[model samples]
Target: MVIQKKVGFISVLFIISMHSWCQQQINLVDKFQNQKIKAVNRSITLYGDQRDAIELNAENSSGIGIIEDLEFEKGIIEIELLGENNPGKSFIGIAFNIQNNDTYEAVYFRPFNFVAEEQIRKEHMVQYIYHPEFTWRKLRSERTGIFEKGIRIPPDPEDWFKVSIHIKENNIEVYVNDLSEPSLIVDRLSSTKSKKIGVWSGYGSSGRFKNLIIK
Candidate 1:
């Protein structure tokens, strides 16, 4: 699917197989029982890890493909993802309750800068972005030490990790790998009635997805 938006300066393109890819997507959609998936740019790869799984790579312009049938006003969203070990790039996470291509609250890990030797780079392991209005660039320039932070127990950025987002009415708690504690917590989130689930990656970043269970 091709999503055209006037905002957000980004996009994605599918590589690999088209026929086989369609078959795979069909199986996944059937398995999930939803057709609202915006797997544009042909970047979503699916598999079964004793269950269902998928991978998304941000190709051209900061790729973000939405899952249309899935919507969440308030709940916990869990995603298991693997990040490509690409250098000099940033991002890997979920954009939930998305209003469209230009609007959504995104929280992703800066794998490329996750465990840098430099103290400043290390502090950017975790980041939060509300697109269009609050891109990562603006967040860093305007609100330093507010939207992003380093992980207390840092994991290998390139390796697979599970991120759980606990969303309440106005609050959010982000837990990575560990469910007992949150790596970052926000007292407030941007307001929206969006129910879309997007597999998001920064421009040129690659991410894999699987076992998405909302509770």
Candidate 2:
């Protein structure tokens, strides 16, 4: 009887430990300052007069706004993103495990492709890539359909949508809005070193981000 009681006590402690280890940390978007991010070929600005979010506008090439104060390894990242329906001009999403401005793994969305009628366009809605090596062009030409997928139920390309990315070890799962199922799942193609996380925008893209939550 005593042994059983001790085992039960251990189980309770284990649950408590796990819960504490996975506590969620919410970032106050309005409190972000321009100086807190390192912008690369992007215009960083506060969005809305309320300043409740940050915006990134890319120039002629892909750009990123890396949060200089934050570092992430593996956890759940949630953020609200807004973009236009401009074809090939509204690519936006999150970048993680960023080694630098030119190196990182990212999962970005082509907003215009959200509800595309063409099968080929729809399949390019969400993309996963590791820079300086595995780019979207190479992935499409070599491992087509493996790293990108069409959203089962597309969201409005010009509206605000929530994205949740789950990173665990070498695997990443992307969830759009409150969907019970992941929109895309892919294995990490680069080193799993802990690094900075940031907002990403492709050429000619403008993105607004807010309400970042890390767990």
Compare the candidates by TM-score and give the number of the best one: 2
State TM-scores per candidate.
0.77, 0.87
lDDT of 2 by residue, 1-215 (tens): 99999999999999999987776554435335536678888988888887887888769988988876676888889988998888878999999888878888999999899879999998888889999799999999999899999888889998889999999888899999878899899998987764789889988888999888888
Tens digits of per-residue lDDT for model 1 on 43-92? 66654455455656567666676876555677777777777545656567
Per candidate, the number of residue pairs that clash is 4, 0
Clashing pairs in 2: none
- Which candidate number maximizes lDDT? 2
| Model 1 misplaced regions, further than 4 Å | 1-36, 40-42, 47-52
- Which 10 residues in a row give candidate 1 its minimum summed lDDT? 6-15
